[model samples]
Target: MSLFNIFNVSASGMSAQSVRLNTTASNLANANSVASSAGETYRARQPVFAAEMAKANQGQVGTGVQIKGIVESDKPMLKEYMPDHPMADKEGFIYKPNVNVMEEMANMISASRSYQMNVQVADAAKSMLQQTLRIGKS
Candidate 1:
């Protein structure tokens, strides 16, 4: 592995964490949304990440992370009886999304922290590389 590969690995991690943060934000935004039925209810979304291996480096892959896809939560939505609710069904019951605000907020914080950590790691690597360049300079 080359010294520059460190930047690539950290960049991939930061990109993956960004997608995670976006999904978490989306889930939190729709946490209070309501639907008359399950079909219309909003489900939480999560990003699936996978690591990419470097064939040239060795059998062991470098830290290259990629988003596989976004998956929706399978948990059931909450059903509430609100006859006056605008989105209520014929039976006067409204279906609220199963999203948990606290959980989503926690996920957001985690992603944010991970992103910051990656940025720090990249910055540290850059500083080290710059210092190395001064080794042979007058």
Candidate 2:
């Protein structure tokens, strides 16, 4: 792999993590939303990522990461009995989003760490390039 490919790899990683963070935030934001009907309930969303590889002389080499798509969780929404709630259904139950606050918090932390690692990789690559340029000055 070429040294320049490091930047591309790190950039893709950062982009993927950004999408993950956004989706996690959205899930957290809707965690408390109540719906009168199951169909109207919000489902937790997650981003799917795939590895991009390139054909090289030796073999397939990793290029970077790509976001395949965002998928909604199939887990059942929370059903709570709140007779006095304005959004309660005919059965005195309200449907809450399937989002788990703790899980979303964990995802947020993981995504943040991945983003930071990618930034470090890019910085290291930049420093290496700068050092390579200075090698000729001596």
Candidate 3:
């Protein structure tokens, strides 16, 4: 692939990772939110990604990543019995989001690292391009 293509690929990766990080943060923030009904509770969302392929001289090459869609987790919500809680239902049961704090933290870390890696890749490509330009000056 060309040097320009590298920038495009890395940029797409960074964008996707940013979306992932945002979703993870949202999930973490709502983890403790309580609702009287399951329908009113927040469900964890996950971003779906797909590889963008290009038909090149060589068979096929991945150009970048694309976000296909965001889907809500199918995991069951947490049902806690908290009679004193104001949001509790008539049965003294409160529904909490299915978001797992530890899991979301891990995902946040992973997404951050992935974004950093993409930045590094773009920086390396830029450095290489700059060095190539210097060759003409010399």
Encode model 3's per-residue lDDT on 29-81: one tens digit a residue.
99989999899999999999988744443554647888999999999999999
Which candidate has the highest lDDT of all? 3
- Over 36-91, each residue of candidate 1 has an lDDT whose tens digit, in order, gives 89899999898998777454356644567878999999998899999999999999
Model 1 residue runs over 4 Å out of place are 54-61
Instruction: Please provide, for model 2 over 1-138, each residue's C-alpha lDDT reduced to its tens digit, 9 standing for 90 to 100.
Output: 667988888999999999999999999999999999989999999999987744343374647897999999999989999999999999999999999999999999999999999999999999998999899788
Please state the error at residue 125 of candidate 1 in Å: 0.8
Model 3 Cα displacement at 96 (Å)? 0.4
Pick the winner on lDDT between candidates 1 and 2: 2
Pairs of residues clashing in candidate 1: none
Clashes of each: 0, 0, 0
